[model samples]
Target chain A: MNRKVTPAALALAFSTAVTLAASPALAAGDKDKGDKEKCYGVALAGKNDCKAGPGTTCSGSSNRDYQGNAWKYVPKGTCKEIPSPTSPTGKGQLQPFQEKG
Target chain B: MRGGGAGAGLSERLRGAGGLTVEERWAVALLDPEAPTPPDLTSWNGSDPGQRFAVYRNNVVVSLVESLAQTFPVTCELVGEEFFRAMGREFVRARPPRSTLLARYGEGFAEFVDGFPPAASVPYLADMARLEMHCLAALHAADADPAAPQVLEAALREPECLPALRLRLHPSLRCLRSEFAVFSLWDAHRGELEISQVNPLAAECGWILRSGLEVRLLPMCAGDCDFVEALARGNSFGEAAEAAAGDREFDLGRCLATLLRWGMVTSVNGIK
Candidate 1:
């Protein structure tokens, strides 16, 4: 039972698809539940969500293992759980941390 | 490494150690109004290298000022053109770009505006610069496919499980909280919608998120902003909810639904 898509519905679907398919990598999303997060000092280099800091000419150009300024979208609970070798305390921090390495 | 090391050693001997590297002297010469070109300008083919360097200086200053104008169009519009260029000249002199990327060069420009005594009359100028610069950053940030609405719905349907699962935000999502109306100020500065009207005194909270082709500077409240920041920091649903709780009525369900519809959420978990 396939009816022809109305222009309204067609446009809606097209827009939705376009919206979803835009940027293929990096960055964090936010909604009210407070469940989602962008944790800094946790992203792997070249895999940072965004904000790689000064001297980084490109989006994902994190220099070290866990550059403090680079962020990754992680679950809120997982932020502290994830281990950062360079972190001052060797643990994830809420704010950007000065890395050892 | 060999070529770079050799070049550095020669440059040091030519320009003297701890004085100014060849490139540093060139940059300094570019800013100087005097037409006397540094000996480092030997690469230039012109007979009058000093004159040529002056021409190059003018070109560099123009280009840098133009880039600043583009990055902070509103600030340019707010301050007269002559005045803006003067300010741009100072900014260039003080904080030259360390990297080749022009887009990311002016990260400190907003802070510069905040401390600028000339712009003291318009204190919100700094926040406006911050917003505009953020908009630029959002444009270049990595993108992501938001989680399907159904996935979010399913998570919401099970309130208990929601606390355990992590949500990922879209790569282009950027949030700003300011003591000034950033969005409307940005709106007023747009070329097509040039309606120069906004309240400078009122505090504002805003989020910049990109859809398919469009980037939105949407107004949000502090409560919701806190909620989003918490989540972005890797807070769990329950923890975020508690942190987001305040005098304001934070409709978690509706807000989450809007974010899903807008394609701001990347996934229900790290699976994405």
Candidate 2:
């Protein structure tokens, strides 16, 4: 009980404690559940069971293994899956790509 | 307790006031807006007026030329570095920066390049500069949401029966079609590709769009290129697409996928 704690050990223990305490709060502060899911959705889509990163959540896209995670501060409607060869087709009408001015 | 009150030395009194003489004030304003114009050259700590003026002049010239260099990289590349620096120096002396933002400093440089005698060998260099400026502007243009694919899908379902369908484009999309392969040249230069392997004669219609955090360049087909040009002119999606599809190579499916992938489509508004 009287053993001395070295400065390095104390620092490491302090950081670990801080991380453990802060993880839940950080997760809760991430407001958009959809974005969190989408950010880690890529991993989910690949059928790999991965823990959601801090401030992110994972959700399933139309593809079973494909998951999407959205970040908290990213505005709504900003996050979309990167178009790959296997991405879905024929859901909506064909529209011309709008060029931003 | 201060005895030398009235004439505590003119220098000390003037120093306290921090006032500048007319000539010094004029020189400082001419050199830099922020510089304090001191009253007399005799009062200056070390440098004489001529020396100070030379330093200021050099700084102003160098800064102006640097701004031009950023605005016209292709023009510089074509002329070679040493020649470009000389040309830039001449340009700075002829026309100084009028605005604080260096980005807008070279609005007239394309015309300047066009008229320069030495640059005559490469007639298309000026056009290349113009195209680069457009790309720069487009890359920094305002951000907008791509139109929801669901809404566009609905519109396409009733293509024949639909009224006006207005399409909103992302703010950062731009296209430039040119007879020369200026796009390819720019691409090679920007991407740091080997210039020897590139064919300057190859023509390309370049489209630029920002997806997520990065800006990308797309090679446009004849019909899609025409369609984007029409949209830029404020044509409705239906109109622009029809004009585009009039070309035999226009494939609706391919265009839609490209648009979606690029995050170029913003909103589809159907007429009430």
Candidate 3:
């Protein structure tokens, strides 16, 4: 009267357990929500704490909290800051903090 | 018909090949490490070799010196423009760029500064260069997803059972403990504030981390620095804390909170 599970069934059970164990209560997509959207500091130009989004310009003076820190959210119309012409931003657009050479 | 003179055909083919001899390679590198090929004398066909060579030399020296200036901005500022350029020329002669990435071009500078006669008086200069190099390395490290507080809490619950809880450090986190307050020297040159209040002679532990795109420096206690080093080596949180708490000044709660806020903790594992 002993019942044994097949290897396939056991693997399925194990995988389900692993998935459940690894999955957080919050949705997977929401992991970076806090970091992706919330603006932590104001821009150096005294503009709005530029919303955390793609193409944001950040620098040492961008915001006190974010100063000397990397990865500030650039709001729309704001250009990315390039340390040098050789910087990854390429050459077309002017970075917010760069002086024209 | 008029151009195929003695050795002229051989020279033309060699020039077209554009490869330099060992001596020529060294000479070109000595002039400009970034230049892909040695200058072809044939291109100047009857032009003034002196003028062309001068222009080429100037371009090479200017670009190399500029790269050094960018790499060590604070050092250049401290030494002044003219002296820094002179020093840069020396450095270029000694160690040319081995890679195209200028950010990585000055790895040996701190060591060079140690032996550099003119910079001998500024004993802190080498240490400052080391700190700057660490900052650069931290900025370019690969990104990682930080671990959540709940995972850490869970691991802490079974500290004894947790088999070496692996904590992943942020890619852009770096720590440098030096006998001189090199961080202050960097800050002074940054021109952020007037009346700099840093003691260049004092020993300090400086940590750099990339929050978003900016690199922030944090001065840490010796115990905290040791704790970070331990964690970086893949020690469990409990083990690292134990080592850290060896120093009476280590405050576990505050350290954990600071790391969390900085996004320095990338991942935590060992929780079942």
Candidate closest to the true structure, highest lDDT: 1
TM-score of each: 0.66, 0.58, 0.66
What's the residue-level lDDT of B125 in candidate 1? 82
- State the lDDT at A53 in candidate 3: 33
Best by DockQ: 3
lDDT of 2 by residue, B43-89 (tens): 24765765675566678778778667666777678778888888777
DockQ in order: 0.02, 0.01, 0.04
Docking class of 1: incorrect
Q: Name the Cα RMSD for model 2.
A: 22.0
lDDT of 3 by residue, B242-261 (tens): 66666676555556556666
- For every model in order, the TM-score on chain A comes to 0.58, 0.25, 0.24
Q: Candidate 1: where are CA atoms >4 Å away?
A: A1-101, B1-12, B34-36, B43-46, B191-197, B247-249, B270-272
Q: A7-73, model 3: which lDDT tens digit per residue?
A: 3432333234334434454122323434333223223322223332335543332322222212334
Identify the superior model by lDDT, candidate 2 or candidate 3. Answer: 3
Ordered from best to worst DockQ, the candidate numbers read: 3, 1, 2
Show the lowest summed lDDT stretch of 10 residues, model 3 chain A: A61-70
What is the DockQ (computed on Cα atoms) for candidate 2? 0.01
Per-candidate total of colliding backbone pairs: 12, 28, 10
